[model samples]
Target: MSSSERACMLCGLVQTEAEFVSKGCANCQSIFDKAGVDTIDCISPSFEGYVGMCKPNKSWCARWLRIDNFHQGLYAVKVDGRLPVDVVDLLPHYIPRDGSHVE
Candidate 1:
């Protein structure tokens, strides 16, 4: 599919012709971009969480996913040559329990 026709993985919003393949739809991408993460990877690990690096300084933001207290996702994170599994675990706490659905 063309970039503009791509859908935002987070919000399912169709991107404008000018915004295909950009982090996400304008709204979701804006939030991710403002997060100041240099690179975002949608990877899966054996554990449970979303792993990637925050750009520029290469900081890691490892986000773990839980469905009703059941671990369900894993992401490998490498930032500035350092690994931070503990920090990534903090993501589950930040995710809203009610709105934690992923598509």
Candidate 2:
């Protein structure tokens, strides 16, 4: 991935850092908004495996990555990071799929 690209810690969606700062996470926007968390705090520059999901509902890869319900876009197979403690505290119902927290 390019240096400017970052993966959303909540959904693994990949986009430029600038885009993240401007738009927040496409899939988890409402969650972040409710938590009052900024996109910059929910993205990781270091992620592995790139996936271009065109049909999330039909793609096996998207299902495997737990992103089948999200919008079509570039995604990281695994995002490496954790949400800030304050953000987590604010989002008691939010379960992150970034591998930072165990289910």
Candidate 3:
């Protein structure tokens, strides 16, 4: 991939194919050097409902996000609508199945 392919979320530095999906880079370390909040804590919460609240209805396409510092989470972005059951099945093994708080 090229630098324009995808940039690191933590830093504005452009990424090549090798680092397209990396959690962070040297630039990220510099940016977060004095930051108070953990960049990984800023993950989007759209999938929380599907994986935690609605796990008995299979009506959406859900998948887990495997990024570092953002593990134990699922994403249902490609899904058409809410899907409880499918979300449950797609939950990562690291996540609890007892409908516990996943934030």
Candidate 4:
């Protein structure tokens, strides 16, 4: 791969940073699609989509980011413009009815 391109950390297919991280390539996106994943914008999701997606500018969008929040699958969000709101109430579409989040 040329220095201008970076190998997708998951699929190892070289691509631009913007494509690999923010907007995935065809192969990676296809895999996500097959797995029922959607890259909807994190903060302002359509609420009818699958898993939430992050923008390249968001701190969590960085491939190097490592955290303990819901296996990093759950991102922090505000409800009613407040912090520390209940997870379910914050993202009713993402959190399960039984109060169980993706493990």
Best candidate, lDDT-wise?
A: 2
Task: Show pairs that collide, candidate 2.
Answer: none
Model 2 bad stretches (over 4 Å): 86-103
* Residue-level error in angstroms, candidate 2, position 10: 0.5
Candidate 3, residues 1-103, lDDT tens digits: the string is 2223333332123334344335544433433434443433322212222232123133232224223232222222221122233333433553432234367
Off by over 4 Å in 3: 1-4, 20-24, 29-103
* lDDT: worst 10-residue window of model 2: 92-101
lDDT of 2 by residue, 1-100 (tens): 6999999887889999999888888898787777777778889998998889999999898887888999999988778789877667876576666565
lDDT tens digits, residue span 5-101, model 1: 3222332233343443334333334444544432222111112223322231322222232222212222122111211243234345333222343
Best by TM-score: 2
How far is 76's C-alpha from truth in model 4 (Å)?
A: 32
- RMSD to native, candidate 2: 2.2
Q: Is candidate 2 or candidate 3 better by TM-score?
A: 2
TM-score of each: 0.27, 0.84, 0.21, 0.24
Candidate 3 lDDT score at position 65: 27
Model 4 local distance difference test score: 0.31
> Cα miss at 11, model 2 (Å)?
0.3
Q: How many clashes in candidate 3?
A: 2
Ordered list by TM-score, greatest first: 2, 1, 4, 3
Candidate 1 residue spans exceeding 4 A from truth: 1-4, 21-24, 37-103
